[model samples]
Target: MNRSNASRGGVAVLVLAGGEGRRLGGGKPLRRVGKRTLLDHAIERGQQWSDTVAVAAKSADQVGNCDLPVLIDQPGIGGPLAGLASARLLDCPLVLTIPCDMPFLPDDLMARLTAVLGNEGASLASSGGRIHPVCGLWRRESLMQLPAYFATGRRSIMGFAEVIGYATVGWDDHWFVNVNTPIDLAQAERRID
Candidate 1:
């Protein structure tokens, strides 16, 4: 049986690791933040929300040694949306999406997103008027709406969120800082220390 499909209920965590991370000199998931790689940190956080956590990557080779299932980006689609598209296949009603680089993503992410999920297809995280659509809880049934949305040739994550009528939960901006550069990694290291 597929590891991702082993769980039939409760929220599943999908850690997005498919980005090329060119800005960080590549191999972003393998980059170290203290003792663990960025991907390791991400998986650790995801485990806080669910035992059925998976990583979404550009390829298995990119993900390296992750014990969790790696959902490769959909053939024709790329980026976080592709990961989400693939994650929807997991045997869970709700999927919580997190990024590989954001080590400090709010611990209460699931709590906040679930509070607003209500009747909408999604509940995204926003901070200081900026939306972090990738770090959100998604409805698997609603994710079935992707093929039709992509049919229009529009790939913006926010665009699909809008099409599905999403709700937003606010957080302090510092909680969403992602490691995308050497300096950003240094900052994360400092934050960890």
Candidate 2:
């Protein structure tokens, strides 16, 4: 892991806590993983990648006391796309989108993703042949294409990646394991041990 690149570029990280977390009984980001909430872990880890870490939550009220700036989803609650756009609008060179529910994300994620910077719009981290779209890094410039993509009403991140052609960066599957259900949280708890 390249600790040296911990703070790279004028990058900003957007922890997408705007999801309803319907699969995990709601407030998943605030769920405890060990001694810390998932949102706490997300923000703590996010601080390593960028000095300007912000959160995109469903409502500002959901993350009121967070150390970072919290932006509410625009009137529509447009999912990760809106979060990504909000982060980009900060005008940073790169903005990494991480799902708040993914507490065990690799610490070196931003370094690994930005390692292939000059590739297409962005390169998603892939493990075991599955693309972790929300666990990926994107350039602020990529937002230029998002508006047009949103116009099509297809909000899938993979769909947008396909339209823009992204490079693939490989990482260990454990590094990208997302905790969505109680079962997943239990499994991740064991993994951490």
Best by TM-score: 1
Q: Which ten residues in a row have the lowest lDDT in candidate 2?
A: 1-10
TM-score of each: 0.94, 0.88
What would the per-residue lDDT of candidate 2 be over residues 1-193, giving only the tens digit for each residue? 3555544547888898888777788887788788788888889888877777889987876665787788776665267776766765665877888888877788778877888767578778888988887877787787678778878878787887787777778887777778788888888677656
What candidate 1 gets wrong by more than 4 Å, as runs, is 1-9
- C-alpha local distance difference test of each model: 0.89, 0.78
Candidate 1 lDDT, tens digit per residue, 1-193? 5665344248899999999999999999999999999999999999877878899888998889788998888887877888888887788889999999999998889888999999999999999999999998999899999999999998888888999989999999999998999999999998888
Clashes of 1: 0
- Give the residue spans of candidate 2 off by over 4 A: 1-9
Cα lDDT for residue 64, candidate 2:
53
Residue 19 of model 1 has an lDDT of 92
